[model samples]
Target: MLNGVSGAGEKPRVLTGDRPTGRLHLGHLVGSLRARVALQESHEVFVLVADVQGLTDHFERPGVLRRHIPEVMLDYLSVGLDPAKVTFVQQSGVPELAELTMYLLNLVTVSKLRQNPTVKTEVAQKGFGAAVPAGFFIYPVAQAADITAFGAQVVPVGEDQLPMLELTREVARRFNLLYGGEVLRAPQALLSASPRLPGLDGNAKMGKSLGNAAYLSDTQAELRRKIMGMFTDPAHLRASDPGRVEGNPVFTYLDAFDPDVARVQALKEHYRAGGLGDVVVKKHLLDTLEAELGPIRERRVGYAQDPQAVMKLLRDGTARGREVAAGTLTRVRAALF
Candidate 1:
């Protein structure tokens, strides 16, 4: 527990999801998707396809966003996340979430939002300068709405996203204090054990905009090309040269994907001792990734072939999510009015 909020011995309500900017990639798989699949066994899980929030930066690409919503859902299904166990909600489908966002927004301030580390970093990265979108700037409050609407006790987030979760806690605490009841449950962060997966180009994080991701939907040949070309130790110019595994994306990926612990350790030792080549290591990684991704790719293809059924599953989940959100909204209304 990141903070003391969830009650002991109870099934904690969980809210964790992604914006539909693009099809999910290996980064998504390693970072949080796998964790969500595991969480569904014991806890109540709600996966929000945050198209509304995706618009913060991608408002200009509405078509792209629309196209990816089903793709994102397909990725979720392909990753062994059972829809029977997990509730999937389209952010815009649940009107209560937007209403909650409007109310929660009143509890936060523009200056406070500007001080948020995650938002500040994104603002600079997006090069928004002085023209940051109003919607983009206040998304933390909207996220708070997403959390409290389901009375989510646990929120899965990365370290970089802790600031956003803190803001959510603040909003919930303020609402409860001002409204005179536990109208909102302050959700705690469930941090992922896996570190951020670096881009194939060796960027610090794999991102859709960076064009360096190996997407879940990538063909085997595509995966091979990306893995083979992945950035590695710049100084290791020959097979006989002792390679620095630290900061090398190849080994970083091996650390993440290769399940054979002894094999990876031996490879690392051999590479450091100057006999292993990048090609050999990359070929190993490619095999490891293919073993994992091949099944996922096949499942995604099966889901993709039946888009209507996928949409039906999403609609059903959205209805269930809205029922939960509506109950929360009713409580909030009683608190406010």
Candidate 2:
């Protein structure tokens, strides 16, 4: 159970989702998905494949997304997220989420929606400009429905997503206060502790759109090659030149991957002082990443071979999730009545 909250007997309910825009990359693994696996033992968890939300922005590429659902499920199963322990459901399957969104939207302001950092950032990132779809403009309200429909008390998200979660909480508060009913639960954010993993190209963030990500299913050779070709201290033209470690992404990978923190710390100091070469650091990163990802890749291959099994798992979980969402909708409707 989560500490420091009232209702000690009531287990913390967590709501989390992934936009199935593409195969999940390494950044997804280290950040939120790994935390979800660990939280399952203590909290009631719902993991959503937000295909509907993916369509909000990727409306033009629905066919591409339709093909990636199975691939996304494979990535989730390969990461050891047990379907039995976690409720793994598809967003489109839960009609209640959409129905609830319609009601919740009336309670929130257009200005509030425009202020959402996620909506603003995504619009700029995707160059939606004035051409933003109505659905894309109102996704935070949809997310609020996803959180409240499950009656989730906690939401796990990265720092960049905090504003979105805050909007969800505000929507819940406004609904409860206006309706004079406590039917909707205000969910709080549980920010991830893991450092944001940078991209192989040394970009500030790893993402599919940026073409800087390492997919979870990448093979050992692919992983080795990507890491070997990673951006390092550009100013350090010579191996003997004093490399800057502060912004060096190779060192950032080390900080995220290397189990031997002390050893990695010493390597960072040596690199900064003018001895460590990019090849040496890249080789070390490759070895450490392979040690962690090799097993996951093997597991992914085994699950991928029997695609039916993975689909069955997702289908079964989605059925169970529908039952829960339906029950919650009943209560919400009765309260509104």
Candidate number with greatest lDDT: 1
Across residues 73-128, which tens digit of lDDT does each residue of candidate 2 receive?
98888888877788789888889888889988898889888988888998998898
Number of backbone-clashing residue pairs for each candidate, in the order shown? 0, 0
RMSD of 1: 2.5
50, model 2: CA deviation in Å? 0.2
Worst 10 residues of 1 by lDDT: 1-10
Q: Residue pairs in steric clash, candidate 2? A: none
Model 1 lDDT per residue over 1-337, tens place: 2122247776788999999999899999999988998999989889999999999988888988899998899999999999888989999899998898999988988899999999999999999989999999999999998888888998999999999999999998998899897778887899889999999998998999899999999999999999999999999999999999888989889999999999999999999999889999999999999999999999999998989999999999999988888988988899999
Cα lDDT listed for each candidate = 0.91, 0.85
Give the distance in Å from residue 149's predicted Cα in candidate 2 to where it truly belongs: 0.7
